[model samples]
Structures are given as C-alpha cells and as structure tokens.
Target: MKQFTISQEHISTYPNPIILKKGEEVYYGKEDTEFPNWIFCKSISTRKSGWVPKQILSTPNNSGIAKVTKDYSAHELTVNQGQTVFGIENLNEWTYCKTQNGEFGWIPSYCLSST
Candidate 1:
C-alpha cells in the first residue's frame, strides 16, 4: 500500500488515541465498509495503527498542483485524504488550504507536488 506523510498534527478520531505528528508517514491499512471517513492505517515511526480520515492524504502528484501527500497538522477542519482542497496561501512548511466544503485549514507543503 502507498504511504503518506502527516500534513498536520492529527488526533485520530478513532481508537488507540495515538497522536500523529506533522511529517509522520502512515502506511495504508484496510478500508472499512461501515465508515469511509474512519479508515485504518499503521504508523511507520510509532508502530501504531488506527482509523484516519480518507481526506488527509495526497500522492506525489496530489492535484492542487499535484496529488497531495503530507501527514498531519493542528488545523481545524482537517481535509480528508481524497478531498479536493484549495490553497489559500503557500506557507513554506504548511500551506493554508480550503476544502470544497468551504472548510479552511493548513496542509503540509510536502504533500503537494508541482503540476
């Protein structure tokens, strides 16, 4: 499975309550049929696994410029893995982005690739 780094600090909305930090790479776990948002993945650094929002992810080509990637952040309105986010401003480490739902927050710059 593909891995993505945390774009901002994420307090898993699921169990184990492990605090995920910005830049931590989490391996993709199995998808849940019941809840789409609370899917699980294991952490490479901490050796912990739990459900995370599908929005907080991006690929090498993660499309805002590319596909998104970074791991976690302390922003409110955290974007789900595959959600399309609009950049409000490009900060060096964290880029301020707004979700299509009109939610605003910070996503890590490493997550976005140059298109």
Candidate 2:
C-alpha cells in the first residue's frame, strides 16, 4: 500500500477526469508503466485514474499505465500551482498526462514544475 501526495492542484473535466490539489493523498495502482518516471494511480476516495511521477510515489515502481485512458482525449486538463504530472507525450502548448483518476488529456504547461 503506497501513498502519493499532490504538490499542487490539477484540474480535469468531470465524468471523465479528476481534480486534485496539494496535500492530497493518492493510491498507487500498478508498477508496469507506459513512460519513464510515470506510474499508474487512482484517487484514494474518488477512484479517478491518472499518472504520477515515480519520484513522488512512496515506492520507486508500483503502478501500471492504462493505455485506454492515454488515448489523449479532449483537452480537459489544467495544471496549476507547481503540480507534478507524469508526462506521457507533449505538444507545443499542450501536454498529455494521466489524470489522478486514470484519464489522459491535454494540459497547459505554464503552471507545471517538474518534481
């Protein structure tokens, strides 16, 4: 049982995404990964799917990346306040990241700081 903490806020579209903030705790799901420094995870209470950084996770490797969620659906993510995200792919302005609830979407880069 590993716990992950959010360093900042991450907002995603509801019904398909998640919103997490600093001081929040997340549950590590699978270690098998899709990208380096990224791990599959879920929100402790809401059960949202997303990806978190390996450095921030309690264990180095203990999560799995869900490919279905990584489809890079609608641009519904807004990274803010020094949030750390497992970057799967990146575009010029938007970045594909796993949501805390296991969803992938495009998020802005202005508000992110690598952990």
Candidate 3:
C-alpha cells in the first residue's frame, strides 16, 4: 500500500477513498454504489456516466511509449479512477501507448488503473 496525505480532517475518516480538491484534475476510480462519485458541473448540462475522476492528479510519467499486449476484461477493470482502460486501439488485443515524456511500451489494460 502507498501512503498519501489528506488535505482536510473532515474527510480523513473514509478508507481507500480518493480525495479531490476543487480545481484539481485527477483520474476516475471504481464507482461507489453507496455514494455518487464525480459531481457534474451543472453549468454545462451533460448526462451522468456514474463515474468520477479523482480530484488528485497523478504525477506525470516521464517515459516514452508502450503498448498493451493482453486482455483483462474478465478482471472487471472498469473505467474507474486510475483505471487506464480508455483511449486504446484494441479493446481485447494489444494496444500502443506513448508517454508524454518519451518512453514507449505496452501494458495489459488490467495491469493499469491499479498498482
């Protein structure tokens, strides 16, 4: 498990929950049936997708490019927070990805989103 700092004591009581600050950009995680995740900005009306991107943005990777070489649909790795299953070329096959920095490689869509 990794350690993270909480910005507010009011929200520290929750376990394994992603914290979001206003104006911060983050990734989406698994949907919480008990509590709605991402709150839509009503100023721009849009249909709810029942998912929330984490408010805490991840540190940008300084790698090159890579590709996803396997299938993990059976793992139930939905398009949640840190779930890097989106924007792929093949949903079930290997897909190529390029890092914003410079690294290039492939990863099982499932291996992502989580650790």
Q: Which ten residues in a row have the lowest lDDT in candidate 1?
A: 59-68
Show the colliding residue pairs in model 2: 30-62, 30-63, 30-64, 31-62, 31-63, 48-101, 49-101, 49-102, 50-99, 50-102
Model 3 weakest 10-residue run by lDDT = 3-12
Give the whole-model CA lDDT for all candidates, comma-separated: 0.50, 0.51, 0.27
Candidate 1 wrongly placed segments (more than 4 Å): 1-15, 60-115
Question: Could you tell me the lDDT of residue 67 within candidate 1?
Answer: 18
lDDT per residue, candidate 3, 1-115, as tens digits? 2211212121112222222234433222343444333222111122112223222223322431111122211111212233222223323332333333332333333344322
Per-residue error (Å), model 3, residue 84: 8.4
CA lDDT of 68 in candidate 3? 16
Which of the two candidates, 1 or 3, achieves a greater lDDT against the reference?
1
- Rank by TM-score (best first): 1, 2, 3
Best by lDDT: 2
Please give, for residues 8-29, the per-residue lDDT of candidate 2 as tens digits: 5667654465444444456656
In model 3, what lDDT does residue 23 have?
40
Q: Provide backbone clash counts, one per model.
A: 30, 10, 22
The TM-score of predicted model 3 comes to 0.20
